[model samples]
Target: MDARVDDKVVLVTGASRGIGEAVAAEFLASGARGVVITSRKANNVEAAAERLGEPDRVLALAARSDSVDDAD
Candidate 1:
């Protein structure tokens, strides 16, 4: 479990809950420098990040798979 992700960056989609959330947590635990999580519901993503105790490490953005660039 020595991934040593000290400066890794990960982008996770559909991360409000379920597998995506799990993956994000793992990345953080592995010492990732940053993680960006995207979901249709902005509030959910924000809440999840806050609960994880590193709100600044996560970027919660609204996105739709088909369209791309929902933040625009």
Candidate 2:
């Protein structure tokens, strides 16, 4: 399937590790122009972004998925 996510900005929650991390990577591989990854811990979010190795394309934010304010 061709996702055609190229140049699209994607927001992924719980992206510090596991499936979330995998999904973020897949989006990058699929040619997404920007990927916003979120996790509860700020450090983890930054780490994940570094691991992705695309500072220009990846943005990391610390947020709780259940929190409405965090989503904003």
How many clashes in each candidate?
0, 0
lDDT tens digits, residues 1-72, model 1? 467678878888888888988888888989899998888887888877876677778777877645657588
Judged by lDDT, which candidate is best?
2
Model 2: CA > 4 A from native: 67-72
Pull out the clashing pairs in model 2. Answer: none
User: What is residue 35's positional error in candidate 1, in angstroms?
Assistant: 0.3
Q: Which clashing pairs does model 1 show?
A: none
Local distance difference test values of all predictions, in order: 0.81, 0.92
Summarize candidate 2's per-residue lDDT along 16-55 as a digit string, tens digits.
Answer: 9989988999999999999999999999989999999999
